[model samples]
Target: MVMSRRKTKVNALLSVLISLGILIFINVLNQSFFKRFDLTSDQRHSLRDASVEIVEELEDPVFVRVYLEGEFPADFKRLRNAVKQILDELRAYAGENIQYEFINPSASNDPVKKKEMYTKLSESGLTYTNLTIRTKDGVEEKILFPGALITYRNKEIPLQLLKSTNRVPSPEMMQNSINNLEYNLLSAIHQVTQTRKKKIAWIGGHGEITGLDAYDMVEHLAERYTIFDVNINEKLNALIGYDLIIIAGPKEAISEKDKFIIDQFIMKGGAAMFLVDGLQADMDSLQSQNNMMALASNHNLWDMLFNYGVRLKRDVLMDAACAMIPINVGKFGDQANLKMFPWYFHPTLITTKNHPISANVNPVFTQFLSSLDTVGNDKDIKKTILLETSPLTLRRMAPARINLNTVSIDPGFEKNSIGKTPVAVLLEGKFKSLYANRLTPNIEQDTLIAFQEKALLDTRIMVVGDGEITKNYSNRQTGTVYPLGYDKFLRKIVYGNKDFLANAVDYLLNDERLIKIRAKEIEVRKLNDRKILAKESEIQLANLALPIIIVGVFVFIILIIKRRKFS
Candidate 1:
C-alpha cells in the first residue's frame, strides 16, 4: 500500500509538470508567430488582404478612440463587442502599432462637464443619436454617439460606427452597423495612413451644375480628394494634373475642342465620369410654369459617348417604382387638402446586384433619367449596367409633355416595364479614340501631344444618364442644401445617390479593391419570434435550470470519484 501511494503521488507530479511545460511552450511560440481561426459561416472575423497589408506596413502607431462603452441595450453591447474584436484583430497584425481604448462619453455625472465633453465630441465631427429608455419610475431619454476617432501619424479620421440607413429602429440599425464594422474600421485606417491625396477635377466650361447646386456631392468628395474646377478652353494640357475629371450634368453642349481634350485624356489612360442629361426635363420648370414639356438636349458628346461604347437615349423614363409629391386638391377658399401622388418622371433607379458599386446599395433616385444602350463591337471595351429602372418602366420619347393635372386622373397605365432599362453604365478597357481619323484641331506642331489613336493603357469611364443624380436640393427659405439623396417632404431617403456616386468616383480613381470591400455581406440570422413565444416557458426553464443541473452533476461525479479513491 505504501509503495502504491508513493507511485500515485509521483504520477500526479509528472502530470502537473507536463501541463505547465506545454503551456510555456505555447506562450513562447505565440510570441514569435500569430495565427487566428475563424469558423463562422461567412468568415466575419477574417480580415481582407488589403486590410492586412495596410496594417502590416504601419510605420507609426494607430490610436483608435471608440465612444461606444457603458451600460446599454443588448444590441449596442453586441456592436461594442464587435468593435473590440476587430480592433483586437488589427492589433494582432499591426502588433505594437495599433492602440485603442473605449471611452464612455457620458460617464461623468456633472452636467457642465458633460456638456463640455459633448461639445468637444461634436466639434471633433462626431454626431449623436437620441435614445429613449423606460424604467419603473418613468421614461428617460439618452443621447448616444456611436462613433470612433482613428489617428495615425499626423492625420486623423472619424468613423460613425452606426450608419443611419433609411430611418429604422435600434435593433435593425445595430445589426447593419455590425455588418459594416470591418469596412468602416478598415477604411478609416486606410484614410488616416494614406500619405498622398488624389486630385479630382470637375469640368466647369460645359454649363454643368455648379456651386451650391452640387454642394453635397462636392463636399463628400472633398473629404478624400483635392477638387478643382477645370475648363479645357482649347488647352491641350487642361487635364494634365487631374487623376479624374467629372463632367457633372452639363446643361450646354461640349465644344469640339473640349471633346478632343477629353478624348485624348482617355486615350492616355485617364479616367472620367460623365453625368450628362440626355433629355431636358426640369422639376422646377414644371412647378413654376403652365407649359410642361421636355425637349431633347444634345450636349454634343453623343458621338464621343457612342464611340466609348454607350448611347444615352434622348428620352425620359417613367417608372411605377417612383417617388411621391404632395398635390394641393382643395378649392381656393377652403383648407388645402395635400395628397401624395406618384411622380412617374422621377424613377428610383435599382442598383445592380453583382457590381461592387451597386451591390447591396439602396435604390438611386433620379429625375428625368434617360435609357442607355451599349454600342460598338470593340472586344477591348466592356460595358456593365450599374443602375437601371425597374420592370414597371416606360420610356417617353422627347419632346414629351408633362402635365401636372394628370395627378388626379387615374388613366390605368399598364406595366410595360417588364425588363430592366439601363440608366447608369460602367465602361472599362482600352478605348479607341473618338478623334481618330477625324479632322485634327488647329494647334501648333510644337504642342505636347500623346497622339495615341488607341488606348496606351487600360482606363475606366462611368456614364450616368441623369445629371440630377449628382444634384442636391436646398431649402427655398434658408438656402441650405439638403444632403444628397435625401427627401425632405417624405422625411425618408428616396435614393442612395450619394453612395452610388461616391463608389463610382472611387472606382474611377483606381481604388477598386478598397471599394469592393463595401460589398461584403453578413447574414443576420434571427430567431423565429412565433416559436420563441410558443415555447417561452420551456426556454426559460432550460436556461435557468440547465446550469444548476450541470453543476450538480459535476459535483456529484467528483464526490463519487473521491469516494472510490478513498475506498
Candidate 2:
C-alpha cells in the first residue's frame, strides 16, 4: 500500500508540472510569443524586414486614413483587396505606431458638406476617380478613390489608389510602383517626423527639357526634397545651396563659363546627371525630307565629356530587334516594319552587378546613338556601361542617307560577325574638368568661379548615345502619337525611353531606395511524370496492405517473446 501511494504521488506531481507548463505556453502565445514567426513568402513580404527597423526607430504615431465605400465594382475588387492586404501587413509590421482608419463618404448623404470636403482635397492635388455600373433597368455609380491619407506630425501625405486595366497586375510594373511608394513614404515619415527637406537643383539653359516636363518626378521627390531649376548663366554659386543638380538632355553646346559652374557644383560633392545625345536630331528636316534621317555632330560639349572619360561617337546604331511603325512607303504599301523611331533600338542594357542606378530598370531605348569610349584611366573615376547593344547590331556613320526602306533587319546579318557595342554608360568618381588649364572662352560673363585643381566632385553621371529616344515626335500627317514600340498607353507612358531616363535621374538623386527592393525569383518546378506514376501505384498498394502487415508482425513478435520466456 505504501509503495503504491508513493507512485501515485509522483504521478500527481508530474501531471501538475505539465499542466502549469501548458498554461504558461498558452499565456505567452496569447501575448507576443506567436508573433515571432515569419510565415510570409518574399513576394508577399518584400518590406517585412525593413519595416521592423522602421517601427523600432519610430518615435511617433503615423495616422493613416483610407477612403473606401460599400460594395466595390467587380473590376475593382482585386485592387481593393490588394490595398487592404498591403495596409494590414504594414500595420502588423509597424507595430503600435501605425494607426489606420477607413472612411466612406457615401455613409453620410450630405452633398453640400461632401462636395466641400472633396473640393478641398482636390485643390490639394489629390487625384480621385468615379466608378460607374449599369444595371438591367437603371445606372448606379460610386466614387472610389485611394482612401489612405497618412499623417506624421502635422504634415499629411496621401496614398493614391492603384488600378490596373489587366485583370492581373504585371509583376514587374507593380513591384516598381510599390517599391517606389514604400521608399517615398518612409522618407517622408522620417523627415516630417524629424529633419528638414534636402535641396536639389535642375540646371536649365543648353535647351534641356523644361521643369514642366519633369513635374511628376519633382513632385514625387518633393516630399523629402526642395527642387528648383537654375540656369548656369543666371547665377553659378546659386547651386551651392543644393545637394544635387540635374543636367537633362541639352541641345545646344555648353559654354566654358557654364561648364566651369557645373564643375564647381560637382567639386562641392553635388551629384548630377548628364543625359547627352551623341548625334543632333532635326525633327523638322526628318518630317520635311519625307522622314529622311540627318546626323548633326558639331557640339561644343564633346570636349568636356571626353575630358570626363566618356566619348560620344557620331554614329547611329540600328538593331534588328527594333520597334515597328506603320509607314506608307507607296511601294511596299502601308505596313509595319521593324523601324527605328516609334520602335526604338531598345538595348537590353545589363546594369552593373551591384549599383542602384540600374536596379529594376528594364531595357533602355536609344536612337541615333554614339559609341562611348573610356579615356585616360583615372584611378579615382569608375566608369561602367549601363546600356549596350546586342551582338547583332551595326553602326551607321552620320551624314548618311536614311529612309523607311533602310530600317529593316537584314536577314544576312550574323551575331558572331558584329561585336557587342556600348550604348549608355554610368560614370562615378572625381572627374577633372576639360577646361581645367584652358582660358575661359569668350561668352557672356557671370560671377565666374575657378575650376578645382583636383577632382572637384564625387558624382554620378549617365551618358546616353542618343537623345531622340526620349523626345516625343508626332507625324504631321497622322494625329496619332507614335510610340517607340508596342500597344497600351500606360506601357508607353510608364516604360518608354523617357521613363528609363526618369528612372536614371531618380536613381542618381537617391530619392528612392530602389536598389534595396529585391527582384522576384522565378520559381521553375517540373513534375517527373513517370516517377510520379510509379510512386502513386506503390502508395495505393501500401494503403491496402499496411494494416494487415502491422497486425501480423505484432502477433509474430508476441508469440516469439512468450516462447522464449517459457523456455
Candidate 3:
C-alpha cells in the first residue's frame, strides 16, 4: 500500500509537468505566428481577413478614446461591451500599436467643467445623445456621446458608435450598430494612416450644383480626398490625374468635345458618379400656383448613356410611399394653416440588398425623380440596380399635369400600383467608348487624345436619376447648410442619402473590402414572450429549487463513494 501511494503521487507530478511543457511549447509557437480560433456559430468574434491584414501592417500607434463610459441603460451597456470586445480583438492583432481609453464626458460633477468637455467633444465631431431616466428625484436628463476619437500621429478623426440608418436609438438600431462596429473601427484606422489622400475632381461650367448645395458632402469628403473643381473646356487630358469624378445636377447641355474627353477618361479606367435630373420640376413652380407641368428636359447626353447601357427616361415617377410637404389646408382669422401632405413627387426610394453599395441602409429620399432601364445584353458589362421604387408606384409622362389636391383626391394610390423601376444603377466592367467609331483620323491619331476603343481595366460608374439626393438644404439668410437628406418641411434629417452616397463612392474607388465588412449581419435571438408568460410559475420554481436539489444529490453520491472506497 505504501509503494502504490508513492507511485500514484509520482504519476500526478509527471502529469502536471507534462501539461506545463505542452503549454509552454504552444505559447512559443503562438508567439511566432498569431492565430485566434472562433467557435461561434455566427462568427461574431471573428474579424475579416482584410481587417486582420490592415491591423498587422500597422507601423505606428493608433489611439482611440471612446466616450461611452457614463452610467447608461442596458442597451448602451451592450454597445459598450461590443466596442470593448472589438477593440480587444484588434489589439490582439495590432499589439502595442493599438491603444484605447474609455472616457466619460460627464465624469466631472462641476457643471462648467462637464459643459466644457461636452463642447470640446462636439466640436471634434462627436454627436451627443440625450437620454431621460427616472432617478430618485423625478425624471432627469443625461447627455451621452456615443462616439470615439481615433488619433494617428497628428491626425485625429471622429467615428460615431451607433452609426446606422435608423435615426431613433431603438434596440434594433443598437444591434445594427453593433454589427457594423468592426468595419467602422478598421475604416477609421485605415483613413488616418494613409500616406496620400485620393484625388476627386468635380466637373464644373455646366450649371452644376454649387458648394452651398453640396456643402455637407464636399466638407466631409475633403477630409479623406483632395477635391478640385475642374472645367474641361474640351481639353483632352483634363481629368487624367483624378481618381474619381463627380457630375451633380448639370443644367446645361454637355458639348460633344467635352463628352468625348469624359469618354476617353473612362476608357482609361476612371470612375464616375452622375447625379442627373431628366425632368424640369421644382418647388418654386408650385408656390406660384397649386398646379404645375412636369416636362422632360434633354441634357444632350442621352446618346452616350444609351450606348453605355441605361436609358434615362423622359418622365417623372411617384410612389405611395413618399415624403411629406406642407400645404395650406385651411385658414383661421386670415392666417394660413399649413398641414403636412404626402407629395408623391418626392418618393422615398427603397435600396437593393444584393449589392453592398445600398445594402442595410434606410430608404433614400428623392424629389422629382426619373427612371431608367438597362438596354443591351452586354456580357462584358455587369449591371446591378442599386435603387428602385416600391411596388405601389405610378408614373407621369412628360407634360403630365399635377396638382396639390391630388394627394387627397387621387383615385388609385397604393391599390392600383403600376410602376417598380430602377432609379439608380451600377455598371461595372470594360466599357466600350461611345466615341469609339465616331472619332476622326486626326483626333484618333493625336497622342494627347489617345482614345482607346475599350477600357484599359475594369471600372465602375454609378448613375442616380435625382440630383436632390446629393443636395443639402441651406438657410439663405444665415448661410448655414443642413446635413444631406434633411427634409425642410419635416424639419429633420429622416433619410439615408448621406450613407448611400458615401458607400457608393467607397465601392467606386476599389475599396470594397471595407464595404463587405460593413455588410456583415449578426443574428439577434429573442425569447417567446407568450410562452414565458404562460410558464412563469414553473420557470420560477425550476430556477429557485433545481440547483439546490442537484447539489444535494451530487454531495450525497460523492460521500457514499468515498465511504465505500475507504471501507
User: What TM-score, over all chains together, does every model reach?
Assistant: 0.85, 0.74, 0.83
* Decreasing TM-score order of the candidates: 1, 3, 2
Clashes of each: 2, 7, 0
Top candidate by lDDT: 3
Report residue 503 deviation for candidate 2 (angstroms): 4.2
lDDT of 2 by residue, 1-567 (tens): 999999999999999999999999999887774364445553554553554466567777888666764566644454455556556666676777877777765565799987876776666546666656678778876665644577887778665655233334454445444444454445445555655666777767778755444454555456556788788784666677777776656778777667777766776666776666666665346556755655656446687778777887776666655544444434435643422233333344444444555555555545556677777778888888776666667666776555544544343447432557876777788877655556544332333554465565477777777654454534446554443322332334333454455556555666444334322232324678888797998877889899899999999999999999998
Which candidate number maximizes TM-score? Answer: 1
**CA lDDT for candidate 2:** 0.61
Candidate 2, superposed: residue stretches over 4 Å from native? 1-42, 46-55, 134-138, 163-194, 211-224, 282-284, 291-293, 331-354, 408-412, 415-417, 438-451, 468-499, 511-514, 518-567
lDDT (CA) for every model shown?
Answer: 0.84, 0.61, 0.86
Residue pairs that clash (backbone atoms under 3 angstroms), model 2: 66-147, 67-147, 266-457, 267-456, 323-343, 342-484, 343-484
lDDT of 1: 0.84
What is the lDDT ranking, best to worst?
Answer: 3, 1, 2
